[model samples]
Target: MGQRTLVVVPRPDGGFDCRYAHWGVTTDPFSGSRPLGRDWSGTAVCAELDAGYDRLLVAAARPRWYCVCWLDPTLTDPDDVVLARTDDPDRLRERWTEAKSRAVDAVARGTAPDAARAALLLGLARRADACHRADDASFLRDDG
Candidate 1:
């Protein structure tokens, strides 16, 4: 398996202040995006994850929103990351699980945070899947 990155934007209030635009990049085998993900928006929040096999992802969220961020297209991106954890493994997993559960609720309820995050995460997931097919790194590569 290769390294993966899971980025969790922890907006305790579930609302992410989007006024501060975000940005990122992938430094791996492929430099630029071969099949870049286009700009996306959910519940008025805008996000942009690069279409590269492994790449840049920029997004904004509010406290009222709940959503999980990760590499979901076969999940083989060496750069895929999850939220930073502490020395306590149980606490880390607990936090991850809670975030996911809340996101599901947000999706079902259609309220703030959850709904807002769902919009962006779902869109990002679809785009990531599309990139997997478009770019040729749908799974773990023979060489990392």
Candidate 2:
């Protein structure tokens, strides 16, 4: 399977709206490329939501391999707007579980270029913290 990524954003309902990201999911995949996951960092995620993107689709257009980031189609390049659709919690959860397994396997193999990132994701997923809701005050504070 190709490297799949999910861009999960916060919903007022206390759940996340996970969207699928089609490219630039990982920089390690490209030789000589600098680490570029900053777009999915916690701060970035919060900033995107704070900018009023709640109306976008919350769930993935389809289940992807890895879950991370929040991409606003309006703020991104037209090429970056790959997929958009309604919510599907079951499928999203299934993908999350699958991605966690993939991460575990990738780490155990000890050969994947993204092994370190996989390990980090595995640790977070183990704690049920990968794509779950964030605490508004600490992690996803919205001062609006």
Measured by TM-score, the strongest candidate is: 2
lDDT of 1 at 80: 37
lDDT of 2 at 60: 30
Task: Kindly report which residue stretches of model 2 are placed more than 4 angstroms away from their true locations once superposed.
Answer: 1-86, 111-144
Q: How far does residue 48 in candidate 2 sit from its true spot (Å)?
A: 24
Q: What is the lDDT for 123 in model 2?
A: 47
Q: Among all windows of ten consecutive residues in candidate 2, which has the lowest summed lDDT?
A: 77-86
Best by lDDT, which number? 2
Off by over 4 Å in 1: 1-81, 112-144
lDDT of 2 by residue, 90-118 (tens): 35445544554555456566645355444
- Computed on alpha carbons, the lDDT of every model, listed in order, comes to 0.30, 0.35
Judged by whole-model lDDT over C-alpha atoms, candidate 1 comes out at 0.30
Superposed by TM-score, candidate 2 places the C-alpha of residue 138 at a distance from the truth, in angstroms, of 8.2
